[model samples]
Target: MLAESPPETEQSAPPPVARPRHAARAAGLLIALAVLALVAVASIAVGAKPMSLDEVWHGLFHYSGTVNDVVVRDLRVPRTVLGVLVGLGLGLSGAVMQALTRNPLAEPGILGVNAGAAAAVVSAISFFGAATLDEFIWWAFLGAAVVSAAVYALGGSRSATPVRLALAGTAATAALVGYINAVQLMDTKALDKLRFWTVGSLASATMDTVEQVAPFLLLGVVLALTLGRPLNAMAMGDDTARALGAHLTRTRILSMTAITLLCGAATAACGPIAFVGLMVPHLARLVTGPDMRWVLAYSAVLSPVLLLGADVIGRVVTRPSELQVGIVTALIGGPVFIYLVRRKRMAQL
Candidate 1:
């Protein structure tokens, strides 16, 4: 018995483990925010009629010098605000769309939201001669809603597949573009208006236009944020989500509504700007991982950075003459899109 007791076996313990990765992600997000702030300031200060740092400071708060004050307050400030709104809307909507469809390439522009809004605007201009921003805004909103509903109805089954949604979106986009082209061919006056708006310049932005669309954008943003957790749950497939107590159909419908409002307001404000929606979400995901919370936050900050930076570049590249923000985004986003496709990663969605 004593000999048997002496032969007690030794036991082993598990190795020490690493801390959670979320803390590191939180730190990175803080850094990203700081960088975004710096870029925003640079965007505000370095416009066509270059303002010194001191002038920017005074203009923002104190308000001195007629020219500096007007430039900063009237022109740059409104444009920058719109940029922030548009970026937030596009980024958040893109995130929701991607999550809902489980597709990385899904964006309002790519999925016919922009095309729908644009078609509506074109029809408004061609048929009704609606020249005011307010008139066009309503039409754009209606068009966006219709197209979004169509996309969902066609592509969303008991289990919504990304490929089917994409195909439906593509078909809708093609039809809308064809309609626009036909109108442009027939009506030179409408073509003139469409030519400028289609390129997406922020130059025409005014306080009135900003005010008109701000409520819609704000509502959409709030909905998108609230839906983030649900969307994350939904990404695990509809059946799994249902088992997890998530309402699949309700979530999809609400998400689509939010996208319609966000995309509609953005398109109404800045005419059919492409690629920001598509590019910003992917870029945000790369930085913040797959979490919708982080993705939306990064998008809010980064989208304005891209849109405003593009706008500033547009102002400077041609000096007295300026390129459109839409053109700039297209030039940059098109190549990036191709690269993503060539890399074979985007197709995984």
Candidate 2:
């Protein structure tokens, strides 16, 4: 006799969500959005100088120009807005990257985008005497785009596999990082200018910085949101995606462009923020159950929640002195990432 079939439950896949489930997911998205709003407000209100809710309200609408108002207008608002935009870009890019590669471990920086940006920024300060965000931001974006294109060519161009692309990106990142290290070590002036940015805190956030990056981030968001259905189809396999009219070449090209825009601008504005891109998309998938559409939506909203929450936590945890936001995220995310890796199912998600 043939071996007994495995239990049906063991092989069963998750079913498509019903209307009720969709409604629930929608409600959850709204809740996540509300949490993001609260976190953004907290970022503004709960700094070294904590402000009351009433003060925060006045700081927003009224124009008394008090010390508190100046602090809010000049400092907190820019930081909060930059955090939101950067967080949004990171999360969406990560989700798109993972979907494009069909690799659960992929992130926004998996393409060496951050490394490219940092190298350019450092070179600007060291060799070109470009200190301000205005001058260096453009350099960073240019470097990121150029490096990513080089990585793509090395990864096999049109015939690139996920593994090849990842390997190419890794090699590029290591080389770029070495270059950045050499530059910073040789120039103390560059090191002093870069110290804050390299740590990935929002301390240097300015309205000008936010204004420079916002358009790129918003355009990236629109492009990313459009790829959801195509990504979902591609997740089933390239053949299946092609069968479903997904146009694999077009999707992949668009995905790369969007990732470059999103990651480059975020990195240029705020430096390389660790773990926001890596961790948020996995959490989004956990909540949304692998539907790329819901995954993208949830990531867009929830990533900012995590980033701003981490920023706020960093602010209050050390009192007068504070931890950098990147440090805080790495501290929290490392353990979570270990836990995720240990769970066999998470790698498949």
Candidate 3:
């Protein structure tokens, strides 16, 4: 006791481990936000028609209907805005989907959302002769909603086991893709039109398109952010999540609702862009670790960075002929996906 008393000098406690992680997450989120801003500006400034930073600023703020002003105001602004919205939707959907399925590889398409939307749009083009994107948008949304609901109903009928959900989605996606292909093959006009639509790009983005999808996206995002704690618990496993007082059925329904809204709106607006959802969330997880809240937050910002940056690159690399955002994303995502597979970290989640 005396020896212990002699050695009882005060020692400072070390900082909590979580503090550094939280700090790093905050710093990463800020960097992602900054990159998103930079990429968005680049999206506006470095399109098929170039514009200086000053011209972009003037066009955005003070426009008197000059050519540059028209380009910036009418074209790039909507396109850029749509990119941000679509990216956010896809990114959030992917993160939610992965947690819901307990599969790291899950994306928006895993639920047949994109395939269902594409099939409906293709049918409209072929049989219904819907000429414009605006005309077919309702069909796309309906298809996505129906397919997603069906997936959940089938998967959760007995129990919302991950295997059942994934299998249902895969089967539905295969069927939808088959229908889309059959329609496109039978109608040349549909093929010509659907070709552009299927590849997915912001080339046709307009203020009307942005406005139409904005409300759904906003609602979905608000709802999605609220599910972070539930998702984090779910990531540990259903039993653990339930033991932690999370309502499994309620969480599943809410997650599906959020995914349906976000994916439906995104596919409707931008015509089924791929891989942004698959890749962005994984990248987010790499930075933010297993905390679903941080993963979602990081995804929401960095997804736009990837999308806008890819779009900008597509614009510049092709000069007069730009690649679609979907194509570019696939090109980028394939390698990233492969790397993730090789690393085996994705196997854990």
Candidate 4:
């Protein structure tokens, strides 16, 4: 017994648990940036008219008074810039909406925000004769805010579930769409003006328009990025989020404000471009995991890449008569949406 007691063995420590690798995420971010740069250059160079890469470089860095330079500087440049800004806004807004509603399908286009803005702008055009985007910007902002508030109210208070939110969004969007069609039917002049706005194009992009919406876009982006932590908390269930000391009311209000600013400004600039919000967030999440901060970052970068790339494709595909970016995005997004649905990821919301 004394000999057996002398043979006690020692225990070893457990192996360290492995954390998720971030190098891949960083690489993905870099890849997105590279693609965005390439797409921006392609957007400038590969328009309906032929232009050399040298010309594009000169137009960007060293400008001379030439027709090619003018086209690059005046037309494509503004359009490309607007595309980037709008894409960023829409992409971030979509991620925010999904996080807020805890529904993957939630987006500005789906939630009646764009429809409300469209309705308001048409109302302003037909009734007030607001001919300029500058005049109608306020109308768009007001409409977006009102509709968002209405959706939240109908959806539920602080503890609204995703199903109720989605249902409320669908109902509001349908009602607004019907009203928009009625208004357009009544006023042919308004219809003519609304055609381009409703279709969504960067063709009419001007520096003035860029300047007008820049402030809103910048503010929205900053606010959205700041909300990453709160959003992450929210993704874990409302009770858990509250336990983590996340302010639900404040988060909701700020998130709604950010969405309004982003979507209203974007819809005003380039009609209601659908699917960017829906598609971009999904792609971003695939790269960034379930972390809202990384998801938002990836969405902001990749969205512009998709948007500008689509615009370039639209420009090159038709040759003489170019397709609008909205149409192009729809064509691309429809298949992607179908694929996602088939994958059964939609139910994961």
Q: Candidate 4 regions off by >4 Å?
A: 1-20, 156-164, 339-349
TM-score quality measure for candidate 3: 0.86
User: What is the C-alpha lDDT profile of model 4 across 1-349, one tens digit per residue?
Assistant: 4554332333343333323347678788898899999888788888988788898888877889788888899999999999999999989999998998887777787677887887788788889999987877788888999988888788885666656876787799899878888888999978878887886788889898999998999899999989999999988887999999999989988999999999889988888787888899988887778889889999999889988988888888898778998888889887875676466546534
Model 2: ten consecutive residues of lowest lDDT: 340-349
Cα RMSD, each candidate: 5.2, 6.8, 4.0, 4.8
Report the Cα lDDT for residue 209, model 4. 91
lDDT scores in order:
0.81, 0.83, 0.82, 0.85
TM-score of each: 0.87, 0.87, 0.86, 0.89
lDDT of 3 by residue, 183-274 (tens): 78888766877777787888889999899889988888988989999988987877898999999889988998888888878887878877
Could you tell me the lDDT of residue 76 within candidate 4? 94
Clashes by residue pair, model 4: none
RMSD of candidate 4 to the true fold?
A: 4.8
Better of 2 and 3 by lDDT: 2
Question: Relative to the unseen true structure, what is the C-alpha lDDT of residue 341 in candidate 2, on a scale of 0 to 100?
Answer: 49
Q: Which candidate is the best by TM-score?
A: 4
| Candidate 1, residue 84: lDDT | 79
